[model samples]
Target: MRRTWLATAALALAAALLVAGCSGQPLSEREKGTGVGTLLGAGTGAIIGAAVGHPAAGAAIGGALGAGGGYVVGNSLQNRQAENQQTQGQLQQQQQEIENQRQQIEQMRQQQETE
Candidate 1:
């Protein structure tokens, strides 16, 4: 039983690493979260299932639930990040416009002084 549990754990770790390394490009937050969640959930589920004699089934169910939850959280974070970036862009643009106006006002002042 101890050997079986160790083997299961090893297999889970290997699977997680494989999944994590499958992508060459940088993973999005959602993808990273999903991978992490799957790893954690599967491991936990395997342990629980072993207690009840159904490790594989437990792992599957746990993985699915974890993936869903992780995706939701990651997606929310991604959306917030996008919103913040957009807000920053708008602020920068507004600052630029204000500077342009200041420059124009200075030019007018110079013209008036010249006249």
Candidate 2:
């Protein structure tokens, strides 16, 4: 049983390395996002595959799915960031308007006091 477990662990490690090896190039923003997912998926797949006796196929499918998922997540995060910036800008504008109103109110109060 110990020997079997050791062999399984070794196989999973090798599969993980193989998946890592497959990814080698200049990563774009999308690719970078996908990379983390892919690595995690590959590791998951390796262990699952080893346990179920289909390590290579599982790893391959997992890597592909992970990359696709990661790209989507990255795109979503980027969109959300842009939306936040726009909201911040609008808030700033609103704040400036409020300041102007406060100043006008102060001026009116001063005039009434003098009268």
What does each candidate score in C-alpha RMSD?
3.4, 7.7
Model 2: lDDT of residue 26? 44
Give one digit per residue, the lDDT tens place, for model 2 in 1-109: 5446545654775576567667785444564567777767766776788789877666667767776888898778777877899999999999999999999999999
Best by lDDT: 1
For candidate 1, lDDT tens digit of each residue in 35-114?
77776777787778778988877777777777778788878778888899999999999999999999999999999999
Give the alpha-carbon lDDT of every model.
Answer: 0.78, 0.73
Which pairs of residues have clashing backbones in candidate 1? none
- TM-score for all models, in order of appearance: 0.76, 0.60
Superposition TM-score, candidate 2 onto the true structure = 0.60
- lDDT against true structure, model 1: 0.78
Query: Model 2: runs farther than 4 Å from truth?
Result: 1-32, 111-115
Worst 10 residues of 1 by lDDT: 1-10
Candidate 1 wrongly placed segments (more than 4 Å):
1-23
Best by TM-score: 1
Lowest summed lDDT across 10 adjacent residues in model 2 is found at 1-10
